[model samples]
Target: MDTRCNDITTRNKNEALCNACLIPIKENMRFYKCTYECNFVLHEWCTRLTTELKDYKIERDQLRHFSHRHPLTLVYLQQPNHNADDEDEEEKEKEKEEDFVEEDHHGGQCEMCNKEIWSFHLCYYYCKSCNYSLHKFCAELPMTQQNHPSHPSHILTLSNLVQSRNNFYFRSTDGTWKCSLCNLMWKNIYNYHCSICNFNMDIICATMSEQKINHPSHPHRLERMSGPIVSGCLACGNKHEGEFFQCTNCPTFRINLDCALLPTKLLIQNHTNGTYTHSHPLTLAYSYPHSEIISKYYPFCRVCDGKFYSHLWIYKCDKCRYYVHVDCATSKREPFMSIFLHESLGKTFKNYKEDEHPNLLHCPFPDEDDNLLKHHMSNQMEFISKQHDGEMLNHPSHQHPLIFFNEQTSVDKKMVSLHDPMKRIQLLCDGCVKPITTVPFYMCCQYVDEQCCFVLHEWCAKLPSQVQDYAGHPEHPLSLLPKIPGKFFGVFKCSICELQSNGFVYGCITCEFYVDINCAFIPKEITHDAHPDHLLLRVKPSTNLSKRYCKACQYSVRYSELVFHCPSCDFYIHVQCALLLPKLIKHKCDKHPLSLRYEPVENHISQYFCEICEDEFDPWEWFYHCTTCAQSMHAACGPLILQCEQATYAYDQQSVYRFLNVKFGGTLEIKGHSHRLAFVQGLERDGKCSECDTKLQYEMIFKCLECEFALDYKCASSFVS
Candidate 1:
């Protein structure tokens, strides 16, 4: 695929040559040229990994020494080519044996060192399938902490267990964020770190035995520690689960793995000003401005309102005290990893028309022409909605800039704002007239005048201009655009969110890493009421990631949304699950009060059910319960409350409201049958809902009193909505 139709094999920069794997040929990596007129070219490794050479891939990756009693197992430098015709038993067995998977190290923790290995090159023996890991370069760390630059007064010592497992409260950020050196976040990397000075390091840095480190945390020498640690780390309150470094002077003081390994200096770019602000880059500082400092104190991270702690690595200006978090600095909205484009939108280069692109709208950025952008946007009152009401109002679909709707009718039937309406309408999103599933949508006459009656997902309005690393595609960045411009309005699907959209998309102009607005900037960690005790992390499995469901909602958001997972408990929650929800709520039904409760996962006593919705809910899911009525309802059924006795919240009343799905009731009119429907708890084994003709198992169904008419909650709810 070179620009020149030549059989040249020399390392060249201008030519994009390699064709076997379709990557542009670059210098240094050797490639072979074709002797024939077809002018085909391929990288040397690609040539060996081709489909025809599939059987030889394992042999190439693995090497047996001359005196080898056992074969040295090795993984591929990249994904090895697969054989499509490998239906034979031998190939199947080989596939099962290899399981060749490359793990994404976004938030994995090394069990041995208790430090995250963000880069694979940093660790030699970390396994993704299990928590087992050992840095090949550094086996057991060396002892004797003395003469370090960061600490110089006294010698550091080794200890075991930063804190006992029994006292694992007030957890440290040991495995949560990355090292002070790498600036990457890791959930678990294990090591004693620096015995004194409260310093932490990952396994890779521990291998550098020659350097005795000093840190500002203490006035002493800190060294690499060996053996199991048992005390709690002073820097972070959490008890050490793996290893720790202790201060020889202050025997009680300890530091975990993440702090000891921070780098002394970094030549990082100053993104805020786009310059190298100082002669020296940011320096690692252990003693930083504490929050208690007076006005003229140390610099704090603007991204996260936090001060620089010794155990935590914070970037600061070498010339000044300016500081920031590593993540907030490196994570600029630049696309680097993009994979979907290559596989999905292949003909984009052929079909793309720059001038006719839909994203290139008549509108410019708000910053460029604020007045014009506002004027261009239609300004009209909602059907009954008003912005910034005093009732702490929120739309069912949109969260921000919320309003209250007052739908009323005058004698002429023109329109008027009513303070309270007895019955609520089914809330619908203007984007599509579907009942709003996610909460806090836009309503009122303001949106009505805009032609979009009520409801708009907040993400649909406030989309980020760009996004960085998605689950895969770590090569190029993607851009958010308003779909492909012009006549070709082909249906498009977001790889992350898995929702089909013919609208705006976040796409890499260079590649096809595309996702919908809802999938952008998903939080990596979440503190949830669903799982009250521990923080849930976002884990994107490399394979079969499409099928994992959230434990709370008992659903998955395809590839778009991230899942908050608790590795210890093996619990999973959707990104939506992270949203702050109330504990108590009021519903229109038997109205004493209801408190939110998580249905126990394993309950053999009796299956709990939500009375209002009549939908079988996951016992592990959150629902509202009224002790008085001895009944439960869904938070989705109404706005939740902070406490049972607190003020009533009426699902943040809206003009277009979602109706509660009441399945089995006394008497319901049958459209096709001349009979009143009656609630039925049991019937023959083959009993089904007459409306949708689906089996009603272990749940109540609305059946005609005198005929075969019936309805299940799922179908019946749609009619009511």
Candidate 2:
């Protein structure tokens, strides 16, 4: 076939379907067509590239497909599943009998793509040695394509040159090709060039539907755009991209590409429940209703690890009753989300039934466009289990099913005995390496029976099989591993947190990266009294900076553990350091309840010292620095910060310290003493202090004007300090 008489590639302007690759022809692109009444054209590049590439490992001339194991040979014509070369008469008869009986064996399915073959007439690739088969589109579509679903009726001829033919093209980019559907320009590497219709698509979006899509954020379907519009995205209040998702039901609803394709659900590896399995899955959703009450709840998104803005989409799991931000699952701000072409099937084209596709997310080696890794850990409230069968737990993280026990006196497999005093021992957890004193841990009975000694914390056993974090490695999704190999083979320390945890960890085998449960599973944003001005952001402490002190405990904070820090205020604290003190609590020493104050204000009486523990307190650090009682206490000394009822009287700075701030004379005329005495800051010489009844130093003192006899602050008839 000859489309041109001469080899003048620049002279040819005609564009048509390339008969060899079945793709559109672009202007200035070389092609050949037959003049003998038959209109056939083949791209010049198609002639140079072999139909079957050389296999690096397997047989010669083997097509190395990403999805299949066997080498395939490209065929211009469609081939049947059964090879015509099978020559045995009996075997041929058997094959024909099987082919007729097996309705699915007629090459009605593209094995490599796992997609239905609409028709057998299309060109395909065939494996002569096996039953493997692939569509021609699947084999070649990985690199280049034209005439995509968007502007399906039009031929999107390749536009290698950035300059458009006509100046009438709206919203054109200087150095990039512009997409008609999205109304945005993209780098040549991420997009397919089209000059004829001035239509283009990003590399990933090229194969997707140009019409409608189902995003996890909105309940309604989204329609594709063909032109630029001035609208802000509902998910993120940004007006950057032109192509976006518009609601079918509402005109006001518009989502940018970044928001529309953002992952909404993920499995929560860190859960509130410390049991063998999390009772329910966690989802990203609004913690509060659409009202001003959201501020009262202090809503924060767990997925994106960000503070919540009013009226934004979040991933929510009904069962877990939790919400996370969609952006947290993937770091792809400019992702090519494939539209749901076959909406009649409910889920998008890439998504399948959850039960049938469990392994899709857990696969070690996944395709670049694989949807399973898109939101692997996004929980969808699919937690279904009988409470009665909790003793026989079925956890996703463990290979073998777990069995939990409630406070057993005797141990399984004679590992330890709780009955014998001589054999009493503290069983350290395999996951956290903390004492496993609490009941209800899921132990691997199969392994224990095999004498391997395998066990996990209840919460550790219930961790999600995978985690999805956008700011992490972009190439491969992180997978959960039971343990890592240490210098001692089985024993290992956490790469993050730096604790010697023999527990569950999220790891990327490809990158040789690992993070422990406490470090990996912590929420993205923490709303607490520790730093109330702005929500504390979870981040790895920088090694370049010196170790920071925890604001709560006044202890030096290490960079080994992930800490919460406010960039604006320069406030930093470790997760473990903040958990020490609670909001409010009551102690046996005092009848009234005490509240924790991060920045304890020093007053006239004492320098914010703990009355209970009798220790000096750090006014800037967290403590029960009482402004009302003019007394402070240590949260650690009391050790219990249980919630209690508030007093009838509310704390008023003027009213609470009215008596303490009263005017005092420099010399007090005591009724018991004969004369007026001078008030002093403290005693210069060794003397008794009534508060502690010991040798006084810096203790307030008052002396009689007539005698050398002195009285400490507490013993003085009319005290002054």
Candidate 3:
């Protein structure tokens, strides 16, 4: 058919490239356009000349299949061009054979037969949009087969299992269909179904195709067998009588037919209105991990928080080392599937506007304006601004005038009102309550002889005096407070994170809401690797008393506190847990840095327990693990704080031991006790505080060196000089 165009637009010229040779079609060249509305064309003569070629495409170049969402286009693997100057024909033939059926790593596989597409050059119906392909023969199978051996009573219509089951509620044990012939769970691929009869036959069974299949989960080819093997199935860990596949190389490595056809990756979602979507695609693991250090063969399931038997197959994330039992991963309450529609999924990027705190209508601290203070990386006196004489009068946090110091020094004759200014002592910043190891810090210049008054980090000294409509507590504006007002002892529990701190706080007196300086600056939205698929929006506490738990550690934040919530997937993590859980940590128990594992992996040798605390913890909760040393421990036991060598903690009787650290192990004698008390720590250090009447193990405390007497940090500091 001769079709001539009088005028060609730029768009048509782009599509004018002949699909056969990839060369743009000129005005004089005869070409045939694709029948379908796609970017494909063929040189008229090239189509006729290729009929007898080795890699001849079917007359119909594009197919709209019921199995896939997009139209499948025809593609060919280019053959090596032969010429007069080329080498021997035998060598050329060998090269052609070798290249004939090479594997395409990213090409994926045929949805019809559940087999890898050996070569893109092989004639197949391919969908460029969805990365789906179908073998030419498999695609050409009769769409409706009547008089089939399995269920001959009615006509069977070809259907995509995933598409057909879109409305079906998924169950962990029954989310997919069981093949009528082989009795294996089937999903993701095509199936021949008689809807009225409620009968389904897998494509492999319908076509009676049983060949050596290359399963993505294993390295060796799997041979199809007719009977069940003695060993349990690797995927589900259950022994069932049915058709199965056994690895050709590893005789012991056998899996049921359903497991053999399981999709390579799955996306699981909580269907129970609970927020627990696993961030990464879970891959089917054929064998227990050989890569990580294994203390035991059974791992705890992330979903059910139950122990895994050694034989059960699992779907896991290699990056996070997250593991779950096959059933638990695809359970009805939290059903999972092999594929997802990406566009319908929520955005991963932050949707909330940037925090407007920087552009506040009123400055937090009127006296500590950016223009008023001078900052330097090091102790450079020359760099100090003329306006800043290293001193501030009547600061809100303290009664005494404060002077900034960049380094440790002996008593200075610059009119010091301090008691023993020459004495060396570790200083803690009253703002953050962290030890002030590095200077350019402010200390009370007008000190009372009884106690040192107040100290601050240079940055802490300039905290905003007030913030309005903050995300953490949006109901009311918060005024900065150096310490809790109307309380003799300034220690107060933070309203947001629920951690006790004597640090500077942003509080609203009317609401009785308070957050430490660190919590005050919590961003409205955060992007963490823990849930990389979506931004974690800061959610205000709910008035309802129902407990909401974190996905990572499975711990509950106080109902009155804020949480980092995934807007797209309903996943929730505690704000403090999200910020404090390190991806990797160094511990003395193992030489290697222990990586944070969201879920425990297989270790058949022993039961799960923390190496550091020597206690059992919820395996579903996040933990730090050293695969090299086979050491694992709770995230809390990994020593998130700085080492003791960085700064010595010296608490005086007059000041609160807010961020103070007592020398870990030491003996002290009291007036009434004959034996000295030694510092000890652990969950086992249980007893009421001698003076405070609180639990001793709740905080670092001292126990009697030879008796049962114990004193908490509050009481212990009272005895310090």
Candidate 4:
């Protein structure tokens, strides 16, 4: 056997193989050749490694690895002494096994292959600064190589730099490199790269010394096959011509190079499901178990809400059951998003709980202080079961005292018993005019015809008397009112949404600026799915109406309306469009949910048409599509097109207020009107408004159900607002 040479760092400039590490020794690489006629070559760095020798005494206990910023410390456990008694030796062996289990629990994943450093051999390199770890064999990898097999023309240097990319290199959203050889994205690890040629090979791909690989996605070892194979990849469920790997045991189970090298674990941040954002680590699932499949519906991707093919792989949280598409796991806009949101939002919402009801911030009787309130209530109104009947309140909204009920038992015994027991009646909240389905609510004690006259949700009942720091109207505090305070018609135009509402309003008495209940909870800044790169600012309608069209529906956003605008990107979305147009939804036409697409599908030259209406539509605008079925539809044609339907209130039999899906000639029943109003587009021949006396040309109006009491949408705000 030849002894390894030391103190020999000169470049060999020879095309040969490193006999120690088995990597190619290309031109300009440092290597040693045998002085004898026998051809034997070794890399200069190979001199420091103990070649295939177990239990060899290491000269250095620590090594500085390029993958990590800190020095890596070697953890080694020695064999127990055999001189002990048999019983003692058995006990020591058991203790050693327990220690190994403990080490496995505390161990970190190796940065190179994303596998746990099991310490089975009781030897591994670990960084104390960060939990980055590496196997002993992985530590001997060459830092740089000239004329690598992946890119033989130029030298490949080991780097973790994501920004060093040439024009040919398309950088992924998550700041990871798409390895040139494997075509899989990787991050936070060293990769051999040539910036000049835009070539990159991840550490795992660079170290492949065998044609066979044991992939976590399969139980069998897979052998690489050179091809333009027509078979589909089981990981992504996409069929394309590509070099693939086939299972040695099962030929049918094949994975393309891209899917075979996918990262086993992925950590995503600022990923959104509707308006909710989450940052959780997702584990790559080989496949969804058969038990999890429901009614032939596979797991839905939380980001897009579309059901991906069941056979395809996905990244999911076992606990949350939160599934994400394999391709949608990363975001190229995340780095730009943080900086934009910080500068745009200006204030952090960390203090405010995103899931909490807005009215909970000003709850007069909080759950935490229930006992204390009960103590003080000793001299006050009588109390019932804490779980069911609650303390009574002399609410200002009703003349009679209101009794609180938290559970179905109390509602049944106290209120339901008064009505027909066999009949099922839906209770509508008097505050927001919405159905009171669940929870703590207050019902009027004084009954009219054996029925409670009033009802309010516990949160709705505790609405703050005044919003002192409302983001919409900073000039003055908005006072909560049953209706728009000064309007004789009991309706007011919501300054935020530019819609009319007669329900609850938070209004500025001085400025006459009012926001409906739904609009009142709108955050000052929001991170919408449409514009993930920046936070959308809540901007008061600009006076300039020429460019006030919404990017979503392409409808005109009137100057009097408020919109969520991205000043940096010139993106403006209607408040209703932003809140109501969900990222994913199930339509009647398709069994699977459709995902919203921001732009036209690339390279699709065919004319775009709605799957529902079967009418041609603009492809450049936002639309919903199902990738599995290749179906597309317009937003207006979808079922959730009633985006502006905020609430429904029934004042009486003849007078009801609700958002109607009114078109050019539709009809609706309003709060103040006794009969339904007919929707009509105002014509040049249209007469003046009954109230405002303004000409009704170039506008939408609701004509009186009985007579020519024509009212424009602006004047209609009085009755509906």
Clashes of each: 76, 27, 10, 7
Q: Give the number of the best model, judged by TM-score.
A: 3
- Full candidate order by lDDT, most accurate first: 4, 3, 2, 1
lDDT of 2 by residue, 1-721 (tens): 1122224232254657554444667887886654433233456765444223322334443566534445677544322556567577778757755544211123444653344333222446678777677665555543334345565554442223343355222224554555555555554333444434445565335544434665545677777664555566777654455656678698788877655534223443433122112223434453235563232233334333245566765555453224444443333333333231111101112223545534322211121111111222235323422233656766554567666755664456355321111132324445543334455566665744654344555555555667677233435666777666442212244454343333556777777777655455555545454433345666665564464555555455554446676664456666544432345544554655567665424223224456643545444445564456666665444322121222211122111111111112256665555777665434335356533465443334566656656666566633421
Over 4 Å off in model 1, which ranges? 1-422, 427-462, 471-516, 543-550, 553-561, 576-587, 590-595, 600-607, 613-618, 634-721
Q: Write the per-residue lDDT of candidate 4 for residues 557-638, one digit (tens) a residue.
A: 6765677876665567777666545466555567777777765553343556677546666654567788788788765444
Two-way TM-score contest, 2 vs 4, winner: 4
lDDT (C-alpha) at residue 94 in model 4: 66
lDDT of 3: 0.56
Model 1 TM-score relative to the real fold: 0.28
Better of 1 and 3 by TM-score: 3
Candidate no. 3 TM-score:
0.45
Q: Which ten residues in a row have the lowest lDDT in candidate 1?
A: 340-349
Q: Rate the local accuracy (lDDT) of all candidates.
A: 0.42, 0.46, 0.56, 0.57
Clash list (residue pairs), candidate 3: 77-121, 296-603, 296-604, 296-605, 297-603, 297-604, 297-605, 298-603, 364-465, 365-465
Query: TM-score for every candidate vs. truth?
Result: 0.28, 0.29, 0.45, 0.34
| Segments of candidate 4 deviating more than 4 angstroms | 1-389, 409-428, 433-435, 445-453, 486-489, 541-545, 556-561, 580-721
